[model samples]
Target: MQTDIEVYVLSCPTENIITWLEASFTLVKKSTSGPLCSKLTLLWQGNEVEVTILEQAAGKRFTSIWFDSDKTPWEDDITCAKQVFKALDCEVRCNFQGWEEEGNQDPDLWWRINHHGEGPFIWN
Candidate 1:
């Protein structure tokens, strides 16, 4: 048995660190690979959150998406998925481990998967 949950993708991310990233990031955006700076993994409570830059600075507009943590709620007006990131008071490092593991497993087994990629959901 495995416990799976709804995955959410946040749009138009407005993190305060955007200014730093914009000023310091120098890598050119690639069509497929994109820039390394544009990718990141936001982990909280052992759950995986994929945050990727969807668009570049368009006249001061910076946009990104947060996937896998913004949709679900674990407490009264508090989301368990985002709690860890907030507590750390920092940015998360980008890693493909979580996405690779989930992709290896059946795409539908999402519910059985944990943020740590430890899951193989058993079906009835």
Candidate 2:
């Protein structure tokens, strides 16, 4: 199973993201990495998970949440995306399937969860 998780949310405020992270995980440290990015270090299940929040990642619409560790709780990006959507009550997007270097995959295809529903769609 995949350990790391990366997802994207559309039109979400940075403060809301921090609030959700603080409520869900034990926040260890928070730092402003750049004008449009923030770095967060969190502890989950006794493992350190580094998260990077990047605004305007997709043409000024989507913000990327990158969990840079294999110790994330979820199995994959889609699972993490669902949890994030439920917590933030916003639109979340993730890759349709786990990455496979030698396997055929459509990079534009993504699984999206929003207020309306969840489904697969071409992102770009």
Candidate 3:
């Protein structure tokens, strides 16, 4: 049920990704004032991939981590996800009192980590 890392996705736009892609991006999901977004099917490398913007903590929470990484959207979503989460974390760190591990520093951390749940990059 496993496969290679999904690339060419709408990644969360982590700072690292911003540095990598050298482009600025944003999440187009329900958490914001944008149009309600539904899970969309996209073609990457001629492969069909499933993509969704995961929402957490009720309406106050929102994130589009691009669930599948073995497809095109994976790269775009995760990269963007990383950046968006990082940005969100940077801002909420002071107001939110909790130890949320920022994205890993290792380039292959997401792929190398021993996943206990769903995938290789679940972190814990």
Clashes of each: 2, 0, 25
What do the candidate models score in CA lDDT, each in turn? Answer: 0.34, 0.91, 0.32
Ordering by lDDT: 2, 1, 3
Instruction: List TM-scores for all candidates, in order.
Output: 0.27, 0.95, 0.31
lDDT of 2 at 60: 92
Best by TM-score: 2
RMSD of each: 13.3, 1.0, 12.4
Q: Is candidate 2 or candidate 3 better by lDDT?
A: 2
Clashing pairs in 2: none
Supply candidate 1's per-residue lDDT for 103: 59
**Segments of candidate 3 deviating more than 4 angstroms:** 1-37, 57-59, 73-124
In model 1, where is the ten-residue run with the lowest total lDDT? 1-10
Task: State which candidate, 1 or 3, has the greater lDDT.
Answer: 1
lDDT of 3 at 49: 53
